[model samples]
Target: MYHIRASILFCGITFVFNFVRADYLTIKEERSYADPPTGDWVTNGVITPLDQEMRNFYIRNADGVIEVLLNEDVQIGLQTRVQRGGFEERKVEFTIGGKRFSYDLPKNLYVKRMFKDAEAVRKWEERGRRPIMDGKLYLKPIADHLPTPEQPWISGKFIRENGRFIDVQIGREIFQIGTQGHDGQHRFMGLLGQKDIKPFIQQAFVHGKLRGDVFHASELCLRMLEDSKAQDDPKLGRYLFIGDSISGNYDKALRTALKGKLNIYHPPTNCGPVRKGVENIAVVRRMTNRGLVGM
Candidate 1:
């Protein structure tokens, strides 16, 4: 049996990873949390819903460095396993996804550090493999040349640090940042006057072109609709989404707003109107009955 055992030692942490014998691609991710009891760790990914309720994965590596996986591919991008050990000590038994990643180690350095190096990650992925190193920030650089002059764009980081909004510019654009608390408007609206009623337009004017990040939600929604429509009809191309809005709940309100704009953005002259709703799939049935079928 060929095995590679690596250990990383850090302040208040010690981690060990072992490649055990297995047929399936076995990748294990283990970490210790930073609470009083000290070594609370959890493993989660897209392949399986997290056994725990927390959305953010914050666990310390055996070497004490914070392990962070920013994208979805880390989970469903590759399937892995989890093995829990003693407090502050865990074992990950797995193999690289595709090719065998063998590197001559630099003497006297931590084995975990060598294995977790970015270069190693690049090499491993080059062969269509997945490495099981989690808990480190992954920042892909912005290209020196951006979109053409015709396509004016802006991008920045919206960080809410220490009760203050900080907009870190990314090359040319500045973004707005803010946070909201739970205590706000709530009422029965039971015994209200007739004048209090206004037609809910569900209007949302999303300025997606302002900066690259601003229009992501709108862009994604449109993309999904287009993909679905294209699947339904191959010859006809992509599409757009119209919505209606309620100022109360952003989630449901956005859908309502999108519903209203369907005819405007995707006029009869172009692609027909498409409404993708979350509340239920029945909305599409209603639209079809109204004679607004996809062209």
Candidate 2:
């Protein structure tokens, strides 16, 4: 009876120890990938796959399993490897259905939400100016056409009406462009109606060769300045130039032309690319409120 009881106790203790060890291993595997608490899905950033079979990748969470399909003919691009502290990232790109996509997969099987459209995915791969797709329209960044901060005014949307006219909406302003033009030249209207802007438009035309749209924008700015001056606004005399080395040259030329008529303010350091302006817009707005104009 003593031998029988001793054997039974030994088996029970071994079973309990094995069960605890298995539980620890399971928790450790899940923690290694920084996985969300059982059921949550990653909303953004790199998406790592838990497992892959042929062209289908399966992601298993507490809620259910999600399967991503990558066809065989998809062309994969070069991989980028990044390492920071204890974390490691490997990003891969592939093109499918004429659209390119990219995602980063970690060794521990952690991932983020994938791109919803090709344009959003393409923006990440290309540098400098690129077209952005919003619904049915493909719009260019404002900085690509004008010397303005590239964030706020990101191109325009066009709506076709009656098969003869197209209405273009840029920010809050709308303009009508006809499908037909005189002598094969397109006609642009609705931009020349402001009375205060006419003088600046004439001035810009007399000075040099300038694009019609750019001249219109400059005239609009001038009109704003005139209005502010008329109201004795404190921001009327101040200006801020936010750009790179080339813009510095333009700033110097403008300063010489103004000749103490306006106070020009720019960073003592290089401002880099248009992206820097997009990133620090909040700081720019604060400075503008403090009496800086056209920042």
lDDT of 1 by residue, 16-43 (tens): 4443322222223222222111122332
Give the worst 10-residue stretch by lDDT in candidate 2: 1-10
lDDT of 2 by residue, 1-295 (tens): 0110000011112111110111101112222222121111221111123333323222222212223233333212111221232122333343322344454433322111223344534453354533222111122221121113222222344433323334545456543333232222121222222222221011111001123211101111111111222233343465444544454455556558655565554432344444444223222112234443332
Candidate 1 at residue 229, lDDT?
A: 30
How does residue 269 of candidate 2 score in lDDT? 30
TM-scores of the candidates are: 0.15, 0.18
Please name the candidate that would achieve the greatest lDDT relative to the true structure: 2
Every candidate's lDDT: 0.22, 0.27
Model 1 local distance difference test score: 0.22
Give the Å shift of residue 207 in candidate 2.
51
